[model samples]
Target chain A: MVGIVGYGAYIPRYRIKVDQIAGVWGADVQSYRKGLLVEEKSVPAPDQDTITMAVEASKRAIKRAGIDPREIGAVYVGSESHPYAVKPSGTVLAEAIGACPEVHTADLEFACKAGTEGMYLAMSLVKAGEIKYGLAVGADTSQGAPGDPLEYTTAAGAAAFIFGHDKILAEVVETYSYTTDTPDFWRREYQYYPRHGGRFTGDPAYFKHIIGAGRGIMAKAAIKPEDIKYVIFHQPNGKFPLRVGELLGFKKEQIEPGLLVTYLGNTYSGSSPLGLTATFDIAKPGDLILIVSFGSGAGSDAFLFRMTERIEEVKDLAPKTRETLEGPKVYVDYGTYAKFRKKIRKANE
Target chain B: MPTPARYWREIPQRYRLEAGRCRRCGFIAFPPRLICPGCRSREFEIIKLAEEGRVISYTIIRVPPHQFVDQAPYAVGIVELDDGVKLMGQIVDCPFEELRTGLRVRIEFRKIMEEGEAGIIYYGYKFVPA
Candidate 1:
């Protein structure tokens, strides 16, 4: 009964292509295209960031939920690139959505999985009757070091979910998390960009935790891979989600709908959650979905959900995820991208 | 650095597009006013301005203020919302050449200004192609 009452997603319209980036660093473009399976990635405008994207996505969610923003009793925003290190992103998010003054709010950080961490907390709080409605958002204006591999996919976007006991769209059936002391990726305090363990970030980090959490949630829900109509795994790149889906016994077709990294790139905390929103855009009632998110520290959070009839009513109330992904996009060259991302240091600085 | 109090005080209008509708004359005020200009009535109702609108006038800001130097060559426009409330805001995500009267747009939340590297980030509405 306690589940998603509404959901929404936001992706910045500006994009920087792989060739544009690869040309600057003299890296092979085909490798990034055929290897990583990422053609281009979204770029946030100078005015867009984690907080702004979260507020936009949350507004869409409030519309889909058809509930007064005042009804939201709690708000949680998960992101790695919060604008201010000291200020809480949730306060800004809650206030923009008109959920301020009476809502519990906080900002969460756990790499890419941070968004689902917020989702889990909000759902739990709603199920426990601690609040009438809870808002969970996963958003990021993720950063990549210049010339680093991460630059190909570190992108900007956000997804928001409202959890409540009534008018449930996706009923939460089971939740599970697999975490460890793995340190495959990290950013030190005062560091602008993150450092990763390279090949070590694989096998030992993303794959291990995702598979562990995926199987654990399926077992807890007493369902088989075939029983689920769709599955969304945290997509750091276009290749990982497909490879991991095959390893987890899911068909490519079942995973393809949520495989958004091909166009939108990796939105960090927004990855799996955005995938879920995209799936909801087309999923039929009674369809079962399994979502698993991976974070760099590292860990995975998995949840089993069943679509309800109400999904048909609210799915069309706001902009669909694919519309933004495939809609009008402004492609920027490397120089313009550098300027927009603040990669160039000014003489004044 | 500008006072954070000025930014904080505008949150309701800047963050939420809150407006005041004169209860007496039915006039909508962008930043809710204490007294209605139409009828001089103090009674007003809080309402949200419509998010979708059309461009009534526009200009390109090639030379900009210090806060927007990096974002120069941008477009600013006066949009008349569907609710008949007119307001001015920056028009984004559209090419300058394409901007014209009666172009459709919608309000989106965006960063308006940031004070240096370590100051308050001001957020508000900007117009984007609908």
Candidate 2:
């Protein structure tokens, strides 16, 4: 089965709490904390970006896979915050993980669901016997306009999966995608921050696509929600995944482990994939996992995975997603956040 | 200095930490020289360097370079890897007052500099207190 051989995730250590952002705007901190269900959000350091985070997570994925990087033939990175507008982050990530000199690399952008698009491609390449191994990464140093509500939840992080036919950690049972020409959120060319249609990002965008892909994949796999032991959805906020999970017939217990938006916030492209990584860390052999991702351009990708015995052997090979989230975090104030994000014009400018 | 071609050529060393080791005398070079400084070895083996190292020396730059004016008063240091190769880089995620000789550190990939507004971003290794 062409499935996940190994997986890894990275969440930056710097975090900014809701109160900090709320204080800057003189908004109601209690309402944002209660409404978003996000206490704090991960923030990338001044030196960290999409490429660097992708490399770090990819390295861990390679280690867990225990496959020679040279043997991998393809690498794909999905992100909205690629450091360079034109450069492919896949090349940098592949080189960093020692998969270079012979690799097909591409950078994908489909908003938050782009990472799963990379995963889908890798699965196809591996199952077709066209490549011995392939690596797919979803990562983003997500952007938020100053004083925007998005600033409270948009965060920085990455997740990577190595796909191969042998020693499978989770077998790919089925996959599906649901898409439309709905414009929920977008950032124009040369725009530093994104703009959203507020409430319009809700009904016709995130929910419709997510539910369509989830039900479609489940139907294709010939399984119901009760058959799956775990479920993870693209978490734009802590509330959305929980609400979506319930709407899709999943219990709260099934969504608990993968519900990381409470701690890490929305990692944009990394959202669902990072949730998947966290689930893989805690899932057992023979467990079934259902993952559905929603992107801002109004698309969703869903996959059904069945865990294999090999998962127990390699789950501990890399740092756990929870451990990274629980590691020592440096909290930044609004002034420091402005400096780190370069929101304030410098003397040179 | 931060041109696209120069950045492209340096990626293997800067991103992957790939170095050339002299097959003759076991000497390692960071920039991957053609001839080994030790034993004048003609043959070399490509190797990846260990991520962890020690801060051999450091300097706090208050009067910064043109591109680094915003991030001034930062600390830069020379680190000696376990393989005995020394490389110079910025010391980050640590307090300036805390930086000193013999501090244990680990290398991390980071943005080193940028040319100007809307310019190419240069990425390389930086040392963080382990």
Candidate 3:
């Protein structure tokens, strides 16, 4: 019965249109927009990073969970862009949420699926009766090389899930992970941005693991695609999740609600978790949801969850993911975007 | 560079906005002190300050400090929290022209500054338009 008690999402209010970025490189704007199915992508402020966004998301989660901060026994943050390379991001998050001194904290890294790894760990800890509550957060201020194709999709966002057995919002049915030694994408030590294996990141890395984990979880849960009301997959681009869903026998309508990559772009570790939070904002009680996430190291974590009646009571406790996505966004040009992301070297440098 | 002790010591005031209220004369002090400035009272109570506040005054730093050189021409302000405590921090996520006396604002956790090229990052609270 250990499952999500509450969830929250944070999508930064700044957006840069595909046309805006394409204009800088003299690339075909129409082609990128059509190819990726993404109109614009979120950008984090210079001050905002993985730790700050994680704290904000975790705060909303605590509000929705309606639980004491002291009651949270563990805090796990998953991110590739942790502010400090040596310091643990989870400790800062836990202290910010007032869940300090007696909390187990860890900063995890597994590319796009890192957040779900935290979720899986939190659920396990809660189910084991060792902890009353655990908080799992996936957040990234993801970076891409200037003028690279990855810049168009790598974005900033965060999502948090509070796990507890009491007052469950989405009851966990089963979970599974499919992983292998596939180095489709990687950022080596001392590297500021990640490098990918170009087209190789597609079929062999993301698609294979996601499909394998998705089907494996459904089989383990003894359910078919038609039995699930909603589906969310790790969205490296807007097209991947839709195509993967159809490949797994899910209708477009079943995956559309959670397919937010068209707007927010790929938030790396926050990708699938943010989609799940958005789905939860609109899902009805008893609706079954299937979530599968792929990380490009590579691996996929799949989960089957059933919405609980308590969802309605707490869904509005924090800001909705859609509202943040559709809210008034301050659009920035390339120069400003570079300044905000600290891409341009200062005169002093 | 901010030492580990300095960052650790300021966590209560920086992270949680925990201030100190004097037992005598009811004076509040940010970055909580053992002796109240108002009455020199040794007795104090820890108080969590209100998140919402108003801008009392502001200054745009056109020539910035070392770590903030790239982010020059940014606005920093003195904010008066609803609890009557005032703290100085940067004003973010708003246009500089819009900054005025008594502008409604809310505090958010943000990176205050980085120490050096490869030093511990210092995070603190900043004011954003509410």
- Give TM-scores of the second chain, every candidate: 0.97, 0.93, 0.93
> Model 1: per-residue lDDT, tens digit, A171-285?
9989999999899999999999999999999899999999999999988988999999999999998888998899999999999998899899999999999999999999999
Q: Candidate 3 on A1-349: residue-level lDDT in tens?
A: 8899989898887899988889999999888888889988999988899999998899889889999989999999999898888989998999988899999999999999999999999999999999999999999999999999999998999999999999899999999999999999999999888899999998999889999999899889889899999899999888888888989999999999999999899999999999999999998999999889999899999988999899999998988999989986789998899989879876645
Instruction: Report lDDT per candidate.
Output: 0.94, 0.90, 0.91
Per residue, candidate 3 scores C-alpha lDDT tens digits across B24-115 of: 88898887899988888899999889988999999999999878876788999999998888889999988887889999998888988877
Residue A343 of model 3: what lDDT? 90
Once model 1 is optimally superposed onto the true structure by TM-score, how far is the C-alpha of residue B81 displaced, in angstroms?
0.8
Candidate 3 local distance difference test against the native: 0.91
For every model shown, the clashing-pair count is 0, 0, 0
Cα-based lDDT at residue A224, candidate 2: 86
On residues A78-107, what C-alpha lDDT tens digit does candidate 2 reach at each position? Answer: 999888888788877887788888999999
Clashing residue pairs in candidate 1, if any?
none
Q: What is the TM-score of chain A in candidate 2?
A: 0.99
Q: Write the number of the candidate with greater DockQ, choosing between 1 and 2.
A: 1
What TM-score number comes out for model 3?
A: 0.96
Worst 10 residues of 2 chain A by lDDT: A340-349
Off by over 4 Å in 3: A347-349, B23-26, B38-40
Candidate 1, B9-66: lDDT as tens digits: 9999999999999998998987989998889999999999989999999999999998
TM-score of chain B of 2: 0.93
